[model samples]
Target: MAIRNCLVTGAGSGIGAAVAELLSGQGHRVALAGRREEPLRELSARLPGPSLVLPTDVTRPEDIESMFAACEESWGPVEVLVHSAGAGDSARLESTTDTMWDRQLELNLTAPFRCVRRAVPAMRKAGFGRIVVVASVASKVGAPYVSAYTAAKHGVLGLVRSAAAELADTGVTVNAVCPGYVDTPMTDRSVASIAAHTGRDADGIRAKLAAAQPIGRLILPGEVAAVIGLLVQEEALNGQSLMVDGGSVQS
Candidate 1:
């Protein structure tokens, strides 16, 4: 297999970092872009393959644009884009401020759209590309206290499907991976927040989330990355939402 020129957003931590590491291990030319530089640099150092540490704020359009430009300059046109920079918050409808809702959409949905926008022209010109958006289980099923997050993820799924359909004739593929309760820093904070609010131990809260999945364990970050890896190589799975939610979602 050719070593793809890949760009992973949120590569400083969690699923993003895991994806970057996994791809780099497979000898891909990976660029790590995130809000923090230190972790990106640290992860880059750990990789056997060469990597670019691009500190980027995905929510800022200018930053996102510059990050991709820098990535292309360093590694060539990104043949694969893993949009892993996202966040989810627990806020019931009544308590979900408009600002919070807008920001969630900005980071989780709009950012990926913009990234894809910049990536596709090059991808089309080159004739091969793979784009994966890291969505959440909230995109498929509804949960309380995360209406805004659910809405944003839902939007991302829509974008994936629509874009995939548009590019079906092209060599590029667009897809999404929806994972449930992954054992990442985001889930750690979620567990802690629920524990503090409900007077339960964080471990107990984490266990509950794990139990909600049929597999009865927190999803591993590598598990999600492996799915992305498969999609990047796959020729037939375009426009799909591959679920890595421990069998909680079937379809």
Candidate 2:
């Protein structure tokens, strides 16, 4: 694989961290972008190859622009962009406030769009690019009490498909990775929330969620990162949603 500059949003933890670490290990110049500076710095220190930490809130367009600018100044044009900067919500439709809906859309759907729009120009100039959007299994299947998150993820898939079509033959590929119940800080929080809501022990709630998957366990961050890595390969893979859900979504 040709050495390239890669930008990973939400690279501070979870799937984003794994993807950034993996890409750095594979000899790619990785730019880690996230709202938190501490983890980004830590990851930069730990990862191999050249790495840059651009602390950014993906919801802000200026921040996204600055992140790309920093990457270009430090490395070169961004050859790969992995958008994993998103938030999860669990509120029923009747209980979902307008603020919650807006927040979910801003973080999950609009933010990735802004990041990609900023990066696409440089990618077009280079005539080669790989964009991977981190969606969720909820995008395809209905999960109770998380309508806002599911809607945002569905929008993300739509964005990927539309952008992929527009960038086809332009050497730019756009795709989405839908992960289910990964063992991350986010998942930990979700488990705690479930425990509180159902008055069950944390272990019991976790076990129930894990058993919900056909694999009988929660997915791992590295497992999802591996799928992102595959999408970034030189092969022409675009407008596809690869689910890393432990067989939760068989479609």
Best model number under TM-score:
1
Give one digit per residue, the lDDT tens place, for model 2 in 1-251.
89999999999999999999899999999999999999999999999889998999988888988989898888888999999988787876898999999999999999999888888998888789999999999878988999999999999999999999999989999999999888898999998877787788999888988888789999999999999999999557889999898887986
Where does candidate 2 stray beyond 4 Å? Answer: none
Clashing pairs in 2: none
Worst 10 residues of 1 by lDDT: 195-204
List runs of model 1 lying over 4 Å from the truth: none
lDDT of 1 by residue, 42-73 (tens): 99999999899899999999998898899778
Could you tally the backbone clashes for each prediction? Answer: 0, 0
Candidate 1, overall lDDT?
0.92
lDDT score, candidate 1, position 4: 92
**All models: lDDT?**
0.92, 0.91
For each candidate in turn, the TM-score is 0.98, 0.97
